[model samples]
Target: MGSVEIIFHGAAGTVTGSCFEVRANNKTVLIDCGMFQGTRSLEALNHEQLPFDPKAISAVILTHAHLDHSGRLPYLTAQGCHAQIWMTAPTADIIEPLLLDSAKLQAADAARRNRRPDRMALPPFIPLYTGDDVTSCIGQIKETCYGAWNELGNDDGFRLWDAQHIVGSASVELKLADQRILFSGDIGGGSAIQCADVPLGGYDQIICETTYGDRTREPVLISDRREQLAQYIEEALGKNGNVLIPAFAVERTQIVLEDLVALFESKRLKPFNVFVDSPLAERVTRTTQRHRLTGYDLFSVPNIRFTHDVEESKQINSMSGVIIIAGSGMCQGGRIRHHLLHNLPNARARVLLVGYQVAGTLGAVLRDGARNVRISGHDVPVRADVKIIDSYSVHADRPALMQWIKDRGPVSGSVFLVHGEQHALSVFAQDIRKAGLAPHVVVPMLGESWSVSANHAAKRICPAREDLQVRIAPRDWTASLAALKSGLADRLRALPSDAARERVLASMTRALEDAESIRTIT
Candidate 1:
């Protein structure tokens, strides 16, 4: 038997692209073949060469249907990965339309860019994959119910638990070479469905997400979320303006729809026109309705319409007193951008952002209070009332994450933290150490590999490049530096002789000046 090894291919130092490879017993298994998202630099990584051969992989286990976690499967399929893609039934049903829509977007973008008159004289843009590739990838998917164990290869087995981050999301538990390793796939909070009391302990080693490792959210209840949403809808309607919500197709759209349904069903709000603008979100919403658990029919809301044609979508822009939920949650593409272009400059309109917007996305720009934004080759002024309710976030906050890890009863091995920014990863690693929860906690970088033995001892085989190491202090660097300066000043004042104090202060000033004058390259 060979040593069980894990290689981090993505989501090591950022919040997206979550692929990992586990090798043992002469067989290899992949977990979550997600795509790199957000910044242009990160998106470029999507076109880079994959680290491992696709054909060599035995199987793939998917955690959910979100594009960042499942977007690259078609590319992998195009590259000849014939391994059975495993996921829950809901995920399997939803991923098809999502991936196909992704391909359509890619092809459309390339075409649009090629048509530009000022385009650089470069090679014609080619999409990463086509609609056919999405078909091929969907054909390989095999569904399994949650909590059922499935054998992957000799002496290797895995199971999935409800992660509650979204519908059908899961946390994987794998047994390989006599050791158990748990992979936390974007855990949600206590209020999420089927995850209120998720099992967090009892694994030899844990590979966990730290997406919210450095922050906490306000204590906002579901009632608060619904109340606020109702107020926004009423206020917009009163002004004879529409409400635009740029939502993720899979989970966020469903959640918002459910809340809206509940509000009208309870007679708290009058029935009004609600349009689902994106075809992808509409399809996913229908699939979600079919996959609804017993007695949980959320699609029967009043005054709701699903617009699938371009003309139908265009009609919504001129309508007032309507609620439009559309996708490309980050406002980077899709029908949401069109809706934003129309409504953002209308002073009476309202735009509510519900999901996390990464740094460079249009959603982030709007959230940061940019008065003018470029959309579809035009600059549009932001005259609408934009509100962000972060309480709707699905990812668990820092305290929740710590509690989740601590609930894992007495892990004997180290914790490998992934899926967070450098700041969050560094802060969370130190927090784990200070709490004495683990003997060692590592925030791995891209392409780093580690070996785990049958006894659960782990050793890193490849270190991150020296330049990529996040060397910031655990406490805020500015605060820590200021505290050090204050302590040094006090100690200098305590010196027995004025001459000695003056000498030390002068030396410190010179050192500070020298530090300031030094130039460093990133």
Candidate 2:
């Protein structure tokens, strides 16, 4: 057998964007081609040239339909990649609406930016991929079942196993020549109300996600989670306020709806109208219902209303004492931001955060207790009660990840960790060493490559990009600048007199001038 090489293209040092390249037997396949999220600098990476040639890839094995894991497929296809995209049936269905919605959002954002009076001499903005590109990408997708191995000729193929993270999420086991490598595609905590437990198997080498590797969540049962949701809603309603939930359109929305249905059926929650205020979420809910993936009817309840148009969404602003579930889970975009802009200043309103908020996103700012935030060019004060329900997260925690890794063990080669922040990756690397789960544990950097052989440990073949570590830092410079601007404004407003504020501004200007002069001298 010849040598096998794997490249960490994305999600190596960052929490989102999960693309990997695997090559062997004169064939090159991409595991995923996702988009970077969070900071603007990170999202800008989506517009950069793909590190590898898309035309050179023979096939693409998708792990799931979450945008971070599948968003860039259209961009790949736009760049002339005609490779067959393989995924579970549900992912194939879900990605249609997801990709289309993403294209629409990008186009709208670009148009909005271009229309701005302050755009000045900046070049006209363009979306990364258009709806026609999404159509082409969708045409290339081929559906596969969960348990059967799909042959790729020359004794190379792959099998999909349920990841239990979402409706059709999966972990992939790839066979190339004589080597077997398993890719843990975002493992679930195994307690999700909508999905089943994760399956275990042995592999020669493993590449796992470490999204929650540094922290262990408190164990929560399905009933307990629902109860907590009920209490939060009730508390908010008691104050005669609406409960706003910023949820992802996929598993998070479905799971929240499942719990809500249970609570309503059991009469734990009083009769209150629950609005699902995202068009994409409504589409995903219908897809899940068609698949019969969840035990509960996600959208058929009497009190549940799925708003489909801007008019319907705007109507929610006048309502009170209800629960609103909106998408763009990080509160970065989508209807959630609109909801927050209207409700955040209301002292009676409650903003319920039920998913992981990457650093520098609006959700993280709220989660970190920012008293005021800039939204849609308006500075909005955050007086609404912000509460987080960690149990609602679908990603596996440290304990679950360790158990999953151990269950897939007896591996004779290295176990590579990806899809985590720098600190989580560092902590998980040490944890794997202490547990003795594998002979070697590797934490790959973005764009790094490794050579693997059946008889030897995986060895690094190339160094990662020099600026990758800095680029993937928890908070980017853009977020810092925004914070600095907000803080400076607040400080200026609090000055005793206009003269004092003027003096502060002058001093700041002199300081910047001096700094620029020093840089010029250097």
* lDDT top scorer: 2
| Residue-level lDDT tens digits of model 1 in 1-522 | 336789998888877889999988777889999977664456666877778999999889998988778989999988989999999998998999999999998898789768776566877878889999999889999999877779976668888888878878988888887767889999998643343354546677789899899998888988999999999899998888989999999878888888888888888888878998888887887798787643345556558888879899999877888899998888877889989989998999999999987655678778887776666656577899898878789999899989888877467677899988778899999999899877668788888899876435579998764432332112234333433543565577789999999898899899987887784421
Q: Model 1 residue 30 lDDT?
A: 92
Q: Model 1: what TM-score?
A: 0.84
The TM-score values for the models, in the order shown, are 0.84, 0.95
Residue 206's C-alpha lDDT in candidate 1? 87
Candidate 2: where are CA atoms >4 Å away?
191-201, 293-295, 518-522
lDDT of each: 0.82, 0.89
Q: Write down the lDDT that model 2 would get.
A: 0.89
Would you list the clashing residue pairs of candidate 2? none
